[model samples]
Target: MKFAGIGVLNAARKTIARMLGNNEIAYESAKSQFWVVDAKGLITEGRENIDPDALPFARNLKEMDRQGLREGARLVEVLSVKVVIFLLNFDF
Candidate 1:
C-alpha cells in the first residue's frame, strides 16, 4: 500500500508540474521526493502529497490558476470539499 501511495503521489506531482509549465520532472523514488524544472530551467521542489484519496484533485489547482482564482496559486491551504467547490465555481 505504501508503494502504491508513492506511485499515486508521483503521478499527481507530474500532472501538476506539467501544468505549471515544467519541462523536466525528476522523482527520487528512494526518498519519495520529486522536483520540477520549468521552461527557463528553474528547479523547484514539488508540493507535498496529500491523502491518497484526494491525490487526483491536485490537478484542480492548475485549472484554478487558468481561471485566475489567485494571482498565482502556488499553494492550497486545505484540500477538501470547500476547495473542490471553489475550484469548480470560483470567478476572477
Candidate 2:
C-alpha cells in the first residue's frame, strides 16, 4: 500500500510514525509505503528547517521536483499514491 500525507507538523507525520513503529496497523506486514508533503512541498533531501520527526520520511530531491507545490490537487496528481491523508486544515 502507498500512502501520502499533506501535512507534517500538525500530528499527521507523528501519528503515522507511531503507527508504523508500534506495528499497530500491520503496515510492515503489508509493505506499506508512506510519503509526506508539508506546506513547501514534498519532503526531500536538503529541505531546510524540517521537523526532526519528519526527517525519516524525506526522500531524495532527484525523485521529485524540489521547487515545491502549493496546491493539494497538484500533489495528489503528481504523487499517485493509493491513499492521501490531509492532516492539516487545507482550503481545498
Candidate 3:
C-alpha cells in the first residue's frame, strides 16, 4: 500500500519516525508506503529547502512511476491514494 500527503505534519512525522526507528515498523516497509508533496512537488531526493522533519520521507524519484513527482490535484489521481487528510487549506 502507498500513502501520499500535500505537506509534512511535524508531529506526525516525528511519531512515524519514532515508530520506524524503534523497530515498530521497518524503514524499507514504510518507504513507498509514505509520501508527501510540497510546493516543489513530491518529496523526492534532490528537492531543495526541505524541512528537516520531512527529510526521512524524501525518497528517490526513480522509485515513483513514470509521471514521478506530481503536484497539486494531480497527485490524487496519479497516485490513486485512498485517503487524504487536509491539515490546512491553501492554494497548491
Task: Name the top TM-score candidate.
Answer: 3
**Candidate 3 CA-lDDT value:** 0.51
lDDT of 3 at 64: 56
lDDT: worst 10-residue window of model 3? 82-91
Record all residue pairs in model 2 with backbone atoms less than 3 Å apart, i.e. clashing: none
Clash pairs, model 1 backbone: none
Q: List model 1 lDDT by residue over 42-72, tens digit each.
A: 1122235333433333334444445444322
lDDT, residue 37, candidate 2: 63
TM-score of each: 0.24, 0.44, 0.49
Looking at model 2, report the run of 10 residues with the lowest lDDT sum: 1-10
- Candidate 1 local lDDT, residue 11: 61
What local lDDT does model 2 show for residue 58?
A: 63
Q: Could you tell me the lDDT of residue 88 within candidate 1?
A: 18
Mind sharing the TM-score for model 2? 0.44
Stretches of candidate 1 above 4 Å error? 24-92
In candidate 2, what are the lDDT values of residues 1-92, reduced to their tens digit? 12234333334444655766746454332223555666665555577766665566565565444434332224665477435444342333
lDDT of 1 at 30: 16
